[model samples]
Target: MNNAVTIVRVSLNDANTLLELSRKTFFDAFLSTNNPADMEAYASTAFTLPKFQFELINPNSAFYFALVDNEIAGYIKLNYVDAQTELQDPDALEIERIYVLNDFQGQQIGKQLINLAIQTAVDKNLKYIWLGVWEHNTKAIKFYRSKGFEQFGSHPFMLGSDKQTDILMKKEL
Candidate 1:
């Protein structure tokens, strides 16, 4: 397991690195999808630098970068959404995205990124953290559960042509 991971808030100036790392991490994580078309659709947004730049300007969002030996290992995004709408949270925090390179999956970088997101919310005086993970993504659901999240509900996750069911998980801090 890697013990050299560091968490930092991604800055607006790091736009290029953030976009490139996001693409690397996202593609590696989802490249094995059942549909190639879905993968392509995902890649469109995952690789969009301009969109990331726009997101960086959003004050309500928090983006954390995981670095291992000073290199980008993964990233996670957190945003304030309605907890009452998705899960059991009295207050809401949506884990917008969590991406880690496939080669770094077992190194706990994802864990670090997630914890950072949760901590960020807690720091902002938020009461609960929530996220949606595809039902077919067994590993991700398992990881969320291990982190004290529980299945609050399920909904459709829009992939390219098929909308897969996704489990909405939540945890109170």
Candidate 2:
């Protein structure tokens, strides 16, 4: 398989595809480590077509698909200002989500997406780029740390009714 990656902005027309990808990647990344009921509950609300449609049209939010060999390998979601899940700082960019399929992991796709987020922040003259990762997701935490992010705080993330804590990390531009 080819490893050449392309990042394309997601549009309203891609909502269905994005929804499916979002659900699939979310489950693929967390199902094994979480309660199935929790996963389903979260996915039911978070990965809906209607929700994605709204997000796709939000001026302060953006989505990008990471394609490899013309295949949708993964995707990223970025938010600004009030669109951010937390902080809502006008001068910061929020990485709401970034996920790759199990088959596509370890191919630098996530890295590319992170780089794009950094560049996007720089281009906007943003103060920093931030994200929330599950406190138990050490792999993701390590990845973010490697990209120059440092933990500054945490917030509650309700996955179904689990009420999980997420470590908030940020990379100042």
Candidate 3:
């Protein structure tokens, strides 16, 4: 692929597209490692258009789409302050979600999306960037570590009815 990847800030108008991309990327990443019923249950509440609309308009939350040849290849969601799922630290930003389409993996799309998140935190004078990754997601854990993130803690995560642990990792700016 040519180096035509562009990152654009998402808005309410992209809700439908975001919904579909979110569902597709999410399932593509986790379907094989998770129970189908559990995945369906989580997607039922997480992948709805209405939910996307609500998240899209949140002042403390932001979303960006990584496009290649004008087609979305990935997306990232960020949360600040009270919008953060757990830490809620005023001096930090939370990377709530970052996923690249299966067809677009290994093209540095995920790396670029993460670099954007890190720059955003730096631009805002945030002290650090943080995120949660499933303990079972070793590939993601390694990726984060390579990006200068280190595990500082962990928390329980609910994927449908399955209670799992998420390693909380952070990169200090």
Candidate 4:
């Protein structure tokens, strides 16, 4: 694929494509490390078209897709204010999700998506950006640290019936 990647804001019209990509990337990233039943259960509820459509239209949230040569390679979801999954701090932005296709993992698309989130927070004068990374996702933790994030706390994340811990990390803008 081309090294040049572009980020585009996701709209209601793109819900189907977004849902497909979301399910694919999420499964690719975590399925092997998680129970099949738990993964399927979570995906069934989380990746539905109606769910994606609702998210796309939410005023306090935004989604963006990374395109490599016009093909969808990844996506990022940002939540602000009351829409944040945790903390709900008005001055902070929460990166609710960020995933790249397995085929595109080694590329810098993930970094570009993160930079976009940072810029968005800065543009809005937000004090910081935060996200929850699965405790076992060491690669992601390292990536966030390289971008100046530090672990603040952790919270339980329910992957279907499985209770998992997610390390909360934050970076001040």
Question: Best by lDDT, which number?
Answer: 4
The Cα local distance difference test for each model comes to 0.78, 0.94, 0.94, 0.95
Instruction: Mark the 10 consecutive residues where model 4 has the least summed lDDT.
Output: 1-10
In candidate 4, residue 157 scores what lDDT?
94
TM-score of 4: 0.97
Q: How many residue pairs clash in each candidate at the backbone level?
A: 0, 0, 0, 0
* Model 1: CA > 4 A from native: 81-90
lDDT string, candidate 2, 117-153, tens digits = 9999999999999999999999899999999999999
lDDT of 3 by residue, 4-52 (tens): 7899999999999999999998899999999989899999998999888
TM-score of each: 0.87, 0.97, 0.97, 0.97
Off by more than 4 A, model 4: none
Error of 1 at 89 (Å): 8.5
Q: CA lDDT of 134 in candidate 4?
A: 97
What is the C-alpha lDDT profile of model 1 across 16-105, one tens digit per residue?
998888766665666677577887786786568888887787776668888888877788887764322244343678897898877677
Alpha carbon deviation, residue 11, candidate 3 (Å): 0.9
